[model samples]
Target: MSTLLLGVNGQVGHELRRALAVHGALLAPPRTRLDLTDLAAVDDFLHQHQPDTIVNAAAYTAVDKAESETALARRLNTELPDLLARYSADHEAVLVHYSSDYVYPGDGDQPWHEDSPTGPLSIYGQSKLDGDEAIARRGCSHLIFRTSWVYSARGSNFLKTMLRLGGERDSLAIVADQVGAPTPARLIADASVHALRRYREAAELGGLYHLAPRGVTSWHGFACEIFRQARHAGMALAIAPERVSAIASDDYPTPATRPLNSRLELSRLENAFALELPDWQSQLSLTLHDLLP
Candidate 1:
């Protein structure tokens, strides 16, 4: 089967290319070749490629900037997925799309189910929700995996940012109010491959599922662990454990309001795929190993 993988340059997309290549012929285009910002260009590329399967991992991920760049964010996070879902519906193809936990309102301490009441706090979150709703409404064969706090060894993410700042500065102030799992991009790709294989075995498996590690922590907790692991691995760092302080989300105001609760329930994904996901700490350890020299 011909699989068209979008966002090959992204954290998840980069990993998807590696895992999906073994399954089938993969078509991953660079932005220079086909600019996704151009809707007509995206539609044209879809027709030209005529893929049997499409995996979209690309997203407009600048949370704060998305407030002002609503049109651009909507184009990528909403319109692009809409176009792809339309194609999947008409051609009878399977679509595997990535979504965010920001779709849920950051109110309670409980983990959000796949069918949780969505109340996005920012333009980025709303756009992602819109894309997901569009795909569902299209009534196409699809699998939507909503993940949280994605980071990888290779990408510019929270993990890398902490490592750099930890080494350069003596201390850092991280928001502790927001809580969620730090899902590795590699894990997401592996699970996607497993879900696709299982979905092929039984088509009824296609639908929305929350994909994340088993446990959860706040952004401050995540940064502390990152420093701890990096130090344990004998990596150089200037930040002291005590100096790394935790603050509330309100202390660090940005253009976009962040959801305090990003915890997603993984029972649906686990039961459906029959896989045991690792905890956030263990996942961070593996990613740090890959990153630290």
Candidate 2:
């Protein structure tokens, strides 16, 4: 049976395709090949492919803009995934979906568990949480891996942003209040592949899992590490560490409020799958190595 992968264009999707290349016959549909917004097209594509498994990595990720375009975001984040989940349930296909750490309430500093009460502060977060519920309600064999602060060498992410700013600016004032694991897309994809390989044999699985790097760090800490690596690599930086002052979340107000604690409890995943994600610093170093010219 072939494996059908959706959202082949996103960072995670791209990395997943590369990692899963040798696993089986992979059928990936980019936006041009398969428009997920079109229900008819989605239904048709699933019917034709009839894949043994489906991995959905595509999402409407514009956090600030989602506040204005709530309807569009809901359609993509909520309805579309539900449609795919229903199809997967009917076909008895193993469905693997990616979720975010934003689903947790921004109130505390505790590492969020899979069963924690969800209280999304922004429209995008709310929509994503809704999508998770939608997928779970299908009652199909599924795994919803919730990850946070995803970055990749090839995609637009916090690490890439820091690289550009490091070269251009004298310093950057990053938020120090918000804390979470800075997960690499490659690691997330690798973990998904690991979990899916044991889907059938693992009895304690088939539920949500928190998959991120072992340690957590704020955005300010992440930027500091980025520059440190860049300098070690002999890359010139205009900014100095002292100039990179830490600021509160209110200093840079946005259309949507971000979670103060995006840290996720990965005990369930580690205990069940015996998988341990790398630390944020190590992952950042590897990603920067790939990004450096």
Candidate 3:
């Protein structure tokens, strides 16, 4: 049973390759090898690979910059997956894809469930939501895992940014209004592997699931923890520990509007897969251990 993995260089893709070591053959092409932006190339790759399962972790994740590149972002995020979904349906292959918590407007205090009303605030979010709809409409055997605030030791994420900035400035101001779990990419990959097994076991085990590390935190709180862990690791920093001040989201305006609540409920994942996710603090500690300079 051959499995083809897309976006193997991305954060979740890299970790997924590790988690799915025993799954089967994996085929991930770098951008130079195959540009998913080319719809025909994507279709040809799917047809040639003839994979039993295809995991798409690739996404146009430039949140602020995506405001200007709406068309390209939609092509990569929505159209690419729509093609994959059609292929998977035709070939009878299981398709696994990753999505974002940004699908929700983040206006409410309650955690979002799998069936929540999706109202994306940014072009990035709208593009992802459109892709989700495309996959569902294709009627393929697929699993879509929606996650948020993903960080890894190797990627350009919040943790890395905080550590870099912590070394250059005497003080820092982070948006405190934004709330979500600082989910480690490894956790998302691991859960994907588990869901893959369940997919193989039962044909009916295919749907959208909210996969995130347990607990909730504001951006400021998450940043504070990152710095605290860096300090405990004996890492030097230019910013004083107390200099990390909390500010509202308005302080850091960007091209795309952000959701105030990025939190997602994982009851469906837990109930269906019988998997227990680690606390966000634990996941952060593990990721920081490798990233702190």
Candidate 4:
């Protein structure tokens, strides 16, 4: 059974390529060979490859830009998944998709369950919701993992951005109101493989599950932790020790409104897979080690 992994160049997709290599044939084509924006091209590729499993990691992740690029965002985030789900249903293929917590309303301090009511705040969030809805409505054998605050040792993310800015500036003002776990791309990829194996063992385990680390923290808390770990790792930065200031989400304005609450309940995933996810801080340490020289 061949597996087709999309977004192989992305942070999560890059890690997935390595984590999933031992399973079977992983057909991870680069954008130079396949443009996902083109629905016709994607359909053709699906028909030609006929992969038993389709892992969709590619998405229109430009949250702020997506407000203006509505059509393109819908194409990649909604229509693409719709086509893939239809194909999966017809061909008896399994789909593994990575989704965001932005699909929620971004209110309340309580963690969102897998079956929580969804009310998206932005065009990007709505697009993802549409995609998820399409996948579920198709009734195909699928696994939709909703996660948030994703960062990594590689690629452009909050962790890397803070490291670079901290090294160059004396102080930074980070948004502290928003709260969620900082998920590593490596962890997401690894959990996916584990969940897939468990799904094979119990067919009933096939459905939506929230995927994230155990604990949660605000962006300010995460930045402070990052700085602390960087200093502990002997990395010199221009930012003074504990010089980061906490600011409200309103202070940090963006074209797209960010969800204040991104906390996703992991019991469904942990119970289903019999796994205990590590905390965000510890995961940050591993990613820090890989990132800092």
Best by lDDT: 1
Model 2, poorest ten-residue lDDT window? 198-207
Candidate 1 on 184-267: residue-level lDDT in tens?
Answer: 999999999999999988998999999999888999999999999999999999999999999998999999998999989999
Q: Which prediction has more favorable TM-score, 1 or 2?
A: 1
Taking the tens digit of each residue's C-alpha lDDT, what string does model 2 give over 37-89? 78789889889889878889988999999999998888888998898889988
C-alpha lDDT score of every prediction, in listed order:
0.93, 0.89, 0.90, 0.92
Model 1: how far residue 135 lies from native, Å = 0.2
Candidate 3 yields a Cα-based lDDT of 0.90
> Model 3 over residues 113-227: C-alpha lDDT tens digits?
8898999999999999999999999999999999999899997999889989998999998999999998899999988898889878987789999999999999899989988
Show where candidate 4 strays beyond 4 Å: none
Which of 2 and 4 is ahead in lDDT?
4
Model 3 earns a TM-score of 0.98
Model 2 superposed RMSD (Cα): 1.0
| Model 2 spans with C-alpha error above 4 angstroms | none
RMSD of each: 0.7, 1.0, 1.0, 0.8
